[model samples]
Target: MQQPPSHAREILRLAVPAFGALIAEPLFLLADSAIVGHLGVAQLAGVGLASAVLHTAVGLMVFLAYSTTPAVARAMGHGQLGKALAAGRDGVWLALLLGIVLAVAGFWAAEPLVALMGAEGDVRSFAVDYLRWSMPGLVAMLLIFAGTGVLRGLQDTRTPLLVATAGFALNVVPNLWLVYGLGWSVAGSAAGTSVAQWAMASVYLVMVQRNAARHGISLWPDWSGIRAMTRVGSWLMLRTLSLRIAILATVFVVTGQGAVNLAAHQLAMTIFSFLAFALDALAIAAQALIGKELGASNSVRARQLTGTMIRWGAGFGVVTGTLLAVAAPWAGALFTSDAGVQSVLTYALWILAAGQPIAGYVFVLDGVLIGAGDAKYLALAGVANLAAYVPMLVAVA
Candidate 1:
């Protein structure tokens, strides 16, 4: 039961692509921030606030990807290729259905939510445009995420990485054209992002099939397999659903504070998110390696692999966190010129960043637990976080 030295090395190599792809997403957001920065403080502030509303609303549906992967991976390990594909397809269906709901809500609900967040005249208009513009892209983005899960779960990282790289390029291209060349303003940027998402989704759909076929698997869903997948994946979906709701509640509290306050909080949260998502790929990495080891009946290997993931997650996420704190002012300035806004975000940035070390452990533990098929434990953990974070944020408000 001795740990293999290659386990850590193998995991790191496989994870590198996912980590790179994860980092690219925030970088794409930063591109928007950079584009809007020159527009004026209100535009930047408006974008930040609008982005938060969108993030919270659409982000809740991301459970489709998070919940789908382990089920697919586990099924694949059990020689249930058809079930693995069914799990993936069900995740896509969930994402599409959820996206339809969000799109409807986003189109109709944007103004009221903006007003509720105390968005003023210019800000309210910007938010309305941004949210409405981005609504159509949600399904595409979710599909891309689910597609990524399939690749990651199967330990095939290059496809997602390549697709993400292409998506990043897509973002840059349309953003340039819409924001600058066509002078479409914030609405154009949002539209451009949607375009990029579509590109990613399309590319991933094409790429995933080859990856699947390589393992003697098919990417299409089977009816019987779908039923089986749904039975098991429901709990995972619920576990992820609760966590997303908790995070959204936190954003709601921040939004309720005031637009200026919300803008600041959103910027800080965005900075933190960029780091978190980048490192969370390490968790995905851990899940894959752990599941692989468990399938191979190598418990000792799984433990060692999980430790390696923790080490890498801590090292990378912690450094990024520290640097984010140190550069908070400049980062804040990029998104806003309001001195009061800068003052609030500077502190929040550090506080959020400071938790990275702890979050690193939590992220790795989450992966290990998921890989071990300890979903009930995760359900309990999610419940605990929900109970605590909800009350804490409410009290702070």
Candidate 2:
């Protein structure tokens, strides 16, 4: 019997690197906000509005990673490495196809979408610019999602950590140079991030290709496999869609409060995302490990892993929440200099911090169920959650 300490080590082995990789995703936005913040309130407010739409789009597609991870992990656990690779390949193909469609639509509809969010004046103009420029990266982002899913399925979080770190560096320098050095404004920020995303996608594609070649898996799209992937992903997508709708609703409400409030909300949301991703690292670990365990028919071990991870998630939340609370007063200064935005953000951070424990628990359980391939229930529950949440949100609005 593996001791409890062994379980902790296993979770940490994946979770630690997963933490770094996960946080880097949000760091992209964090960096964007920090750099764009210094431009001016209108600029900052514009990017904020654009990012809400962008994040919602990306969030809805997260099932690419969510679905592929468990399928690949399960197949690998069952000793079907080739099949696992095949699943990953299908995911990439699906990502590419979906990316193209979304990019085209998003590019053409950027103005309408931003307008729909109630943005106006320079904020609307900047948002439209940012959204249109960001279209190119949509495909790359989805590819990265699928590729990261493949690697996670293969129990290779380290590669993602390395790639994401490099990608972050790649994103920041160009953004700084382009936005400041060349005066590209929000467009430059979007362009730089897009380029970095593509670079990251390329690396993932190469790695996936190499693995498929090594395992003698065909790189060609298998329609049946892709169909199957889509079927599973549909449920997960619904679940994700619900979550995105919630966030988007929140953003819409904030946007109506004026640019200053919207800008503050954006910074606060960005920071919240950073912390959420940090906490989700444990969930990522659970997804990988639990899927493998269940695939191997090791229910007992899966249960044990779940218990350990939940505790870790809660504890990690407590620690992070405390730190966030302590830093709340000054954290806004790191992203923006506007005193009004900073003050609003400080209050938001405190509220966010207080909810950390509950969020941590929910995130972990969500991952556990996802890893177990309980998408149908998750989807239904997600709808239920949204139903329950909308009223509260409306009340606040």
Candidate 3:
């Protein structure tokens, strides 16, 4: 039997790199917010609304990565590398297919969607441009999600860390040049990000292809496998949608509070999101490790791993919460110069920090259940959770 400390070490090994990869997504958004913010309040608000909608849409599809990761890891644990690679290939095909459907729909619906969200005047115009230009990026984003799953399942978190780091680094120059030098404004932010997403997707596709060939797995779509994944993913999608609904509900309430409150909420949400990725790194590690253990029929070991991971999650939450509390004052200044917005943000940050422990536990358990192939239960629980959350939000509002 492995020592308890060994489990901690294993979790850290996977988590450290997963942290880098996961954090990149939010960091990119933070960059967009910071840069677009300089254009004025309306531009910043437009980008925020567009981004919120985009996140909700793509967020539901994240099951592509979550479902694929555990399935591939399980297959690998059974010593079926070829089978695992084939399963992963099906996920990639599904991602590509779904991405195209979403892109078309999103482009067509951009203006109406922005209107539906209650934007008007310059805010509406800027949001329409940002939302439409961002659709192509969705395709690449979905592909990357599926590809990351394959790599993570193959027990190679380092690849995603390296790719995401490079992608983020490359994103900065183009974004600055297009937004400032070329004067594309909000549209430039979307275009620069779209280019980076596609580059990352291309690299992942090549890597996946090479690995498939090495394992003698066919690159062709496996309809049966894809169907199975979709069935599982549908439930996961519901789970994700439930969470997004909660977010949108919160945003809706905040928006009613006035412009300063809305701006503060966006800033606070961005920071909370970035911090979440840190906590989520441990959850990602749990998915890969727990799935592999369960696949090997080591239920006892799987239980042990889950227990250890939960503790790690709690520890991380404590550290993050402390840091967030300490940095709240300075952090607000980094994102904006508005004193009113800064004051509102400072208040929100404290509330977020207070939820860290619960958030950590919930996130880790969510990942563990997914690894155990309990997507249906997770989906049902998501609805119940949302039901509970709405009333609280309403009361607060």
Candidate 4:
């Protein structure tokens, strides 16, 4: 009999492409920041503030992906392709419903949300504009999340990488033309990103539809399946919400400091997000692989995979942290020309760099547990984490 591939090999198979796809998601923000940063400090700060709100909203819905991935993977492991496709379809439908509601709410609440973030004057105006214009893309983003989850559960990360890369490339030109050429300012950047997001979502929908048809799965939304998804997702959402709250609180504090500090925080946060996603590739692998292993009732393989991934996560973190630390001073210049913002950003980047190893270890274990369908424990852990973090945040404030 032929021997199976090594655990590391299996992880890299998924992780390499996952890394590309994962980073591409954040590249959307990075691209926006790079493009919008040149407009002026106020513009960058405004986008930064708006993004925190946008990210918080979308982050809450991440269970669409997280819940779907393992559910589908488990079904597949049980040799139920139709059931897996059915589960994925429900995730897509749920995404659509939530996306529409969120888009409307986001559009209407744009100003209030920006104000709540402590934005004012030109920053407030710019933030509201970006937030409202970006609403359409919010729907697309959730769809992408669901669709990407479907593919990941099916053990195919390459397609997402392709779609995301194309979307990123598609995003740049329009943003440039709209912001500089048409002089639409922050609104233009938001519009361009929204357009690209829709395009990517379209591709994912087409693929999902094709798969469903091939598997003889109905395209209609199964309310029952969606309910099941949400049931599992609630715990995951709570887990995710805790993390978002931490991030939002950080932004809230920084926003109070002044435009320069807020702008610097945004740049540092964007870089931090970029690195976080890069590290999360291994986590993504863990989710898919561990879920499948557990579904197949192979706890031994699951545990082995978990150990290997943890090591990889830590090692990858060290390398990324070192690079980030080395790049801290110069990295700020890439986003903005403002000397004050650049100086503050350098300090933030150094701090972020120092935390990467811990972040990496946490991310992988989170994925491992998530893959195991241990959502309740994760949710409880999230609360504890938030409780611990809040005091530190208060001290900083």
Q: Considering lDDT, which of the candidate structures 2 and 3 is the better prediction for this target?
A: 2
Give per-residue CA lDDT, model 1, range 1-397, as digits (tens): 4446787668777778877777666776777877765665566667776787776655555545565667666766677766566567656655566678878888898788777766677767887787788888776877787787776767777778887788888897888789889998888888998888888887766665665576565555555754654555556666776776776566667666765676676667667777877777788887777776776677876777877777777787678778877887666777667777788988888788788888877887787787777877777777787887777777887
lDDT of 1: 0.73
Better of 1 and 4 by lDDT: 4
Candidate 2 segments exceeding 4 Å error: 1-3
For model 3, residues 236-283, the per-residue Cα lDDT tens digits are: 999999999999888777766666777777788888889998789988
Query: Per-residue lDDT for 370 in model 4?
Result: 85
For candidate 3, the TM-score is 0.97
Cα deviation of 226 in candidate 4 (Å)?
0.6
Residue 39, model 1, lDDT? 67
* Per-model TM values vs. the true structure: 0.87, 0.98, 0.97, 0.98
lDDT per model vs. reference: 0.73, 0.93, 0.88, 0.92
Q: After superposition, how far is residue 384 of candidate 3 from its true place, in Å?
A: 0.8
* Error of model 4, residue 127, in angstroms: 0.4
